[model samples]
Target: MKKTILAAMMFLLVIVPALSEETITVKGSDTMVILAQRWAEKYMQAHKDVVIQVTGGGSGTGISALINGTTDICNASRPMKPSERDKLKARYGSRGVEIKAAMDGLSVYVNESSPVTELSLQQLKGIYTGKITNWSEVGGPNARIILYGRENNSGTYVYFKDNVLEGEDYVSSMQSLPGTAAVVNAVARDKNGIGYGGAAYGKGIRELKMKKDAASPAYPPTLENIRSGDYPVSRFLYLYVRNRPTGTLKEYIDWVLGDDGQKVVTEVGYFPIR
Candidate 1:
């Protein structure tokens, strides 16, 4: 009888821990993937019973996952479109909840070898619209310009199109890469290439200082500039949920908006919303 009791005790010990553990799945926004992973790593370290899984496909992909009930949290580099919110309202009877988690500057990346340093919004529009195909047009060398950009499914892609391109179509010759990292890699390898992505991934590349127009002073995507609204392309990063969080989910979300989570944001190379 003592042996039987010991066996039962052992089984209970194993089963209890398994039952106590909780999992949260985070999906979307390649731009925010590194930041999300860091948040998860730190949060899980402090809370031993919680597990977090993070993945990045793109913000659009993440929102779709949220609508389909596949992800617990959706990270987005841009605000959700009205259509997406409408769909969520129709399906779940909730407009969903949006939490601004961090800030980022949409940086334009160029090869380190490139001589060009700054671009006005007009010049950028011309370059992306295929009207300015030569580097010399933008104060660079007399060579053909190569453009790299994110795929249509990415939130960054939509944001860029709406803001930078003014709703115009991207030039057909531009190469659409899968993620910001890939765009950065492509520009790093090609001396004449230029791409745009989140500022966090600007390592080993030159980020162009941006001017709102010819009359305005150019501003680099520094923390001060982004936070102060001096940077022309600064935007907020977001976390979205299908409904008002409850229980463990509420606690986790609250924790994420607190100081510790914002600290993780700054450490991961993005500006904290707080």
Candidate 2:
């Protein structure tokens, strides 16, 4: 009888732990926060024991946290930079694993009330750099462009600067918001405001048309354009994890990659990589 009881207790011990897993800490790009939150919510449904703490401090903040071992995942809308890779390698013995979770066709949005409808990449560059302040300079009414942007630490900001702005500087007049949602709100109300963010945030806001040059008219960003690489500012959203993820970490990562979890990605405004 004692042997039987001992065996049953052992089985229960194993099952209890499998049933209740602790929370996984994930932090990173504001652009991916909405989708990540959705994943976290759904992930918790089957995994009543699993909790995911999702936070946005921008990609840089998330990377920093990852290096410090404070987070299990670093979410990003852009690929890891060399310096950041080096830092992760130094701390974790190798650069953390990069998992491309979804795709985003970024949009430059403005107040719907604004007359401006299109802007070539060059015109956008000029506008953001303070070289061309008036909307009329880019096919709109005579009004100063109120530039809204994600802070320098944001992956969206870095991606935009590297691609569309061609490494140009943001104008001093630009207001740095905390996240993409904030940028959307700012542009939705401010007629003179123009901001760039992930396409997921494009719903209530009007997307600015983008052109490569005078030869191509500005086109609205779309999923097809992003997947085909025609959307100039499209980017991949990723999750960076420590090398050889162990324990629940591995399972959580696997869950996110699975079809059920990835479905949430599309629903939340991102193109699932799967």
Candidate 3:
């Protein structure tokens, strides 16, 4: 009987520690996925007792998860919409907390071999809105211009539509990919292809210098340019929670907004909030 009790006690000791371990769920923003993953990895390394699960289904999806109590953190490339906040307030009686975790310059990408190197915001609007269909229209080869972009559910897509296109619709022919990496990959392979995404995923492709208008000097999405507001399409990357976080959740958020977390942001090719 004593041997049986000793074995049960040993089992409880192991199981209790496992149960005591804390888990954090982070979801949203395909544009922020790599950054979020890097943050999770570094945080987890220091906090062996905490587990962070990160996923990306776009910012809208992540916000929905937060509303439904499915995620502890939602990484958003754009601000939460008014309707979303209303829903959260209705469901949780809290207006959700927003944290500006990093900054990004929304980058326009093209094939490496393309001749076009810069575009005015107006020109970008025309090209994406189906008003300009050929590369020749933008000083490139005579080939047809192929557009690649993210799906409607993406915060990137929403931001581009509102700010770049000025609420105009994307051309029906635009290929809607799942994530920013996919958009970058699509542009890299097609010589006449063009796409937009976070600056971090600009590998193997040419990122165009952006002008606010034809008269403005074009600027690349460099850290200095973005920080100085010279980059035309710079935006904040956010982390949203359903409430004012406390306990382990708050600790993780505090760390993310700290110097070490901002260092990770720069290392991952984004500008720090600070």
Candidate 4:
């Protein structure tokens, strides 16, 4: 009778784990959506019982999702505002907070064939704001500068305007793309067009040197400069979660900061903060 009861108890233990919760969700940061998707794919391989869902709309979308308790994590390409912090505090307490995930040098790019190589921060501001309408104004041939910029929803656009343009509005005639890669592709095809994005996405195009504080850094973007902080436009990437995360959400985030997860970040284009 004792042996039979013990055998029955072992049978229940085997079924409990199989029936436990088996899925996880993460959302945020349109800028990192591509990389996030790639990470999700690999994670789900060994963790077949755990499913990870990722989506990209914009940083605001991600933050809002976190506040509403609609997502496990909120990815952002920009730092949070004081007001945003207050909102999260209201909802989840001060302990609910933000994490730095990686670093990126925002890159200004033009068509590869563009004759111009380097540009000053002041020149970049003028060009983006329509003050310098002609390429010749900055030493290029006599051609109207075709501004291709990210939409207002993008964190990159907001950062550029606030940091480089001193909160100036973009030129009225600028073409706004939906995402970073879109801007890169658009500028690559138009000899007169110029756009900006994360340094990781600036391949096959020429980065416009942003001269800061009279310092002569490299003429364009390079991984080395980005890591060492010589690149002025560089900034940290973020992920916001409750200060004390729980469950699978915590597991996933902890993994991202670990060495193995950082390797994935390096493989995908962004610089690993590790």
Best by TM-score: 1
Q: Tens-digit lDDT track for model 1 on 201-225? A: 9999999999999999999999999
Question: Where does model 3 exceed 4 Å of error?
Answer: 1-13
lDDT of 2 by residue, 222-254 (tens): 777778766666778999987878888888888
Minimal lDDT window, size 10, model 1 = 247-256
Per-candidate TM-score against the hidden true structure: 0.96, 0.90, 0.96, 0.88
Candidate 2 local Cα displacement, residue 208, angstroms: 1.7
Error of 1 at 159 (Å): 0.6
Q: How accurate locally, in lDDT, is each candidate?
A: 0.93, 0.86, 0.95, 0.81
Candidate 2: lDDT over CA atoms? 0.86
Ranking by TM-score: 1, 3, 2, 4
Among residues 3 or more apart in sequence or in different chains, the pairs in candidate 4 whose N, CA or C atoms overlap within 3 Å are 95-243, 96-243
80-104: candidate 4 lDDT, tens digit per residue: 7778777888988864567887778
Worst lDDT 10-window in candidate 3: 11-20
Better of 1 and 3 by lDDT: 3
The stretch of ten residues in a row with the least summed lDDT in candidate 4 is 213-222
Off by over 4 Å in 2: 1-19
The reply for model 1, stretches above 4 Å from the true place, is 1-3
